[model samples]
Target chain A: MSTFYFIAFLSIFFSILVISAKNPVHSILYLILTFFTFTIHYILLNAQFLAIVNFIVYMGAILVLFLYTLMLINLNKESEPVKPFMVKIAGVFGGGILAVALASSLKLVAASNPVILKNPDLGLVKNLGKVLFNEFLLPFEVSSVLLLSAMVGAVLLATKDPKTA
Target chain B: MESLTNTIHAVPLNHYILLSAIIFSIGVVGVLIRRNAIVIFMSVELMLNAVNLLLTAFSVYRGDASGQVFVFFIMALAAAEVAVGLAIIVMIYRNTNSIDINVLNRLKW
Candidate 1:
């Protein structure tokens, strides 16, 4: 229980840092830390396959891509324009409203006692693989197609015609 | 492992809900406040992660694998999103030499 609290605290802190950091590189680093804490949370939930997948796909691929783009673009703190104070205040106000609404609504939800797992191996990769391949095969195949299309679309969008320019 | 689940259950499920809600709110604030396009993108990722966390919590509580499977789908979708989204952002930067979303106001016909 203490460990969950500690991990949750670290994740919330790092998420805040990801947004508030002046340097884009620093923000990316903080985002990685946030992902790490999330990975811990997944492990605690006994979703081992997902915990590893989250670590590899998020912290490994997506964040590295973000970092590379930031570096490639060479964005500096000085180059980032500042928003007005009113806008910042409004943002905070909007977020606070959402937080209050969500928190308050949660109180109405009666906490149901979680069913204790008879076979704790449900989240293990072997078990997940069976469930994924057998029950969710259609979505699994569809997502692969989605990924392929996304890759092709990204390449097409990013490439330039030198002659046109 | 059994003891671990017990300990986790000792803490009410509402705590996880509140935590994810707070994180989601922060992401919302970040998206609204940040001017840089990349930062806004990061905030979107933060929101997605918040949803993912909530899904995992529910999955654990119910002893269901479906929620976790959905999380896997969400991750895949997020990856696809980032790939295309960042590519578009890069293309925008190449065209205007700036990634500020405000600069794209020409589209606001």
Candidate 2:
């Protein structure tokens, strides 16, 4: 119980740092820490397969890609463009409205009783694989196409066109 | 090994919902306030993850693996998004030498 609270606190704390940090590199590092806490959360939920995948995919692959992008862009001499004061206030107000609405709606509804894990091994890779292959075969296959298209699109977008200039 | 689910049972689903709500709002605010394209992109990732957490929580409590499966798909989608997004950001930098949202407003002009 205390461990869950502590880890959740760490997740929120690191995520706050991820957003508030001025340096992009610092933000990415903190985001990595935040995702690490989430991995712990998955473990707490007994989702071992998802936990490992989140750790590798988020911390290992995606964030390193972010770091690479930062390295590609020369951020030294160029100054960051700051939003106007009014725009900042508007943004805060809009998000505040959303949060308030969600909170109030939550308060109005009676929460159902939380259930214990009836099958402790439900989250294991074995069961998840059974469920995935049996029920979600199409989406699973389609995701590969999504990956291929995304890869091709990224390569195409990043490369300079020979005919343009 | 002792099962952590017993410990997690001490925490309520409402608490997870609230925590995810907070995280999601923070992501929203980050997206709204930040001008850097990469930070905005990171904030979007943060939002996706908050939903992911909520889905996993529900998955565990209900003894259903479907939610976790969906979470996996979302992660795959996010990876693809970041790949294409960062590539576009790099292209933006090459073309305009700036990754600022304000500068990106006039897309066709």
Candidate 3:
């Protein structure tokens, strides 16, 4: 096994831990680790700009939000209620089928005439900036609008009182 | 072309597929087993990340910058999702004082 495989395996393992852990805080911590591993993967792919952005946005900002949300709830319930045995069995069966289907399809896709890129640049921050401002400018601006809407909607939902008003 | 060829050869396709598979499974298990809405949101993020990984891999293989562009969009959408999702979760918590999604049925008419 190569170093890439090792790192990839580690990333997946930690991510699974993130989901499986009962404690929400622990899950968030594991998610942070998962994000870091993804940053490493991005670096390996030579997407240095993306790696830094991943670190800053996901590990830095998003994970913090996740943690804060968990804290705010203050359930004082130590452990989340375990899912029933029947649900667990169904989950395993469904997940297994999905994985098998995806794996076989991916194998076929990978084997069929592998695409090879030509003249691939480093795609540094500068290059990405240029492309964002030039070719992808419209979509980028639209995304800003989307974010604005989400923010406003969130505030409205959180503030509304069904009982009093 | 030369640089792309080297990059493609550097990372094998199986690596991407395996990562995607594992991450997707995590998301599935999360949605099935976890009752907390916030954690379920995180699980969905996991699934989106898996798809992003595959997208970037294909972009690299095909030597087109578009896939990365899509990843950028996905990230933006994810941030928006979290902002709105957390707010909704807060509302749900406020209403019932519980984040357990299974309990959500009582809120519905």
Tell me the number of clashing residue pairs for each predicted model. Answer: 0, 0, 2
- Which of 1 and 3 is the better model by DockQ? 1
Give Cα distance to truth, residue B4, candidate 3, Å: 13
**Poorest lDDT segment (10 consecutive residues) of candidate 3 chain B:** B1-10
Instruction: Work out the TM-score per prediction.
Output: 0.96, 0.96, 0.89
| Model 2: residues with Cα > 4 Å off, grouped in runs | none
lDDT of 3 by residue, A45-157 (tens): 66666777778878887889888888888867645666788988898678878888877777666353433444355445776777788899999999999999998998898
Q: Which predicted model would earn the best DockQ?
A: 2
Error of 1 at A6 (Å): 0.9
Find the 10 residues in a row with the least total lDDT in model 2 chain B. B1-10
Which of the two, 1 or 3, has more TM-score? 1
Write candidate 1's Cα lDDT for B1-105 as tens digits.
776666565556788888899999999999999889999999999999999999988887787888889999999999999999999999998888898888999
Alpha-carbon deviation at B71 in model 3, angstroms: 0.7
lDDT of 2 at A151: 100
Over 4 Å off in model 1, which ranges?
A: A112-118
- Look at candidate 3 and give me any clashing residue pairs: A118-B1, A119-B1
How far out, in Å, is residue A39 in model 1?
A: 0.4
